[model samples]
Target chain A: MTMIVKKTTQLIAGLIFLYGIYVIIHGHLTPGGGFAGGVIIAGSFILLILAFGSDFLRLTREEAGSTLYENLAILIVVFLAVSGLLATGKIFFLNWIPKGTPGELVSAGILPLYNIFVGIEVAASVLTIFLALVIFKEELAE
Target chain B: METAICIIAGLMIIGALYAIHAKDLLSAVIACGIVGYGLVICFLLLKAPDLAIVQIVVETITLIIMVAVVLDSSREEHFVKPDGKGYMSMAAAVVMTAVLLYFFILAVGMLDPFGSGSLRMASQYINGAVELTGSVNLVTGVVFDFRGYDTLGEATILVTAVLGVITILRLKGRK
Candidate 1:
């Protein structure tokens, strides 16, 4: 909104986004998962929009991209689940990938993958919602 | 710990009541925010860090959206003088709250003390979950591995919701 606000948001938003990614990646070993981390990621983008103004982001064009990303991410999540079935042929959503030792970064089989994809889907969807609302409000004002 | 939780709950109730009765729409929105944030504190006190993190972020986003809406629209709520029916409703609400509070106290009395909750169905998940799912966090193991289907369904629901929002907000339906 103001120069001071824009500068502060420019500094803080990237750190917020990095924190969201950290939460998503370490979800198997920590408290947050895809949903919480995704929301945080969206929050960072929202802060950017609020600070820099909607015109900076080109809302109409970006809305389409966000919707595409949201749909694609969810599709990949479903594919991952089906892949579990294909891997073992016993049941759906099976942990078919090899499980490394617990507490390690690459430990949870298919869990971290789910977290990452879900995180993407959630972040995209939330960003889409905010963008849609803002664009709608702008159209109404016009 | 119980005392702290109880105090926060009390504050939440007060905030909620103020939000309902406040004349200024923006003030009401802020008072409502107080309730959401108070729940975040309660979630932390109850040892559910996951719930706390989600609640806090969601609450902040919700507050931002609500404040934006209120600021763009009307700031003041039209006040109607309370008549007999309004007074009657207030009395009824008070009575209902008291009854609910009594039952809540009874339920809290029966609960296990703080940090000693019985994991009735969760013990199985806790026992061999790390070995079975290879995730250090049992919540993630249970959510993504044991209850993967449920999470998928939730994600689908979110997709459907976003689709609805986008569809409704689209200016041109067919174009």
Candidate 2:
């Protein structure tokens, strides 16, 4: 509960987070895509939590509620798919969304949204898994 | 490349030995993380990003669960100290290190860049997937469609884990 962030660690953690963001934003156009980028971002949070301790992580997790975030992500993606089904009756499902203008951010139709969903799902699932481990550490280990 | 491989091999060896020998469960848990990270690097070098991600995720979960389970059931004091800093420990370390290093070197030398060999087959499958499922991101196409059943099973596993957590927490509270 008494975990305090040192200045150096905070700076380093911020840099890592920014790098993850850079990767996520440029995901579709590059070798590094959403999954790697999302994990990198999640790792930044994980590093900060490990160095600063569980108190800060607890507060963040409490605010975000990764379980809820995870559920919401799936719901949104599934909804997108279902809506596609209802509207078009395309056997290919949501693949019907226009491919748009290729290089632009939204050009890839479901690609961007799928990437976002995956990023959210991965980030939330990873955070929840870590938090769950820490929350039960006392009961499980000590 | 050679140096990175060497370091990975070294880490895997040291981490594996430590994970097995360390009396402190926390130390063992951390050692396993080190080993897992080393394996990730090896996977990355082979350009198996998808495999790397899944393995890293699953392995980290496995380690976290192992440590949590042990901590839940065992006395903290007893597991915190090694039995002895003895000859047996040194022998175990040396043998494992040599074995790991040898295998890694041999494997790396024998294989080409990972996906290169299978490129045609992979693309064929991906192209077929797109025609069949119409998903973008070839990997996603691969993950979600060609292996749709597998994906569904994984989702089922995830839901079950969540349900188990609720059940366990409620039962413990009742006691």
Model 2 docking tier (incorrect/acceptable/medium/high):
incorrect
Worst 10 residues of 2 chain B by lDDT: B166-175
DockQ of each: 0.86, 0.13
The residue pairs that clash in candidate 1, if any, are none
Candidate 2's TM-score on the B chain = 0.57
lDDT of each: 0.92, 0.63
For residue B71, model 1's alpha carbon misses the true position, in angstroms, by 0.6
lDDT of 2 by residue, A55-87 (tens): 743544453477787778766656655666777
Model 1: how far is A125 from its true place, Å?
A: 1.1
TM-score of 2: 0.62
Per-residue CA lDDT of model 2 for B46-154, tens digit only, reads 7777668656755765675577567656634353445567667978999999999999999898777744654567767845754444443456555544543454345
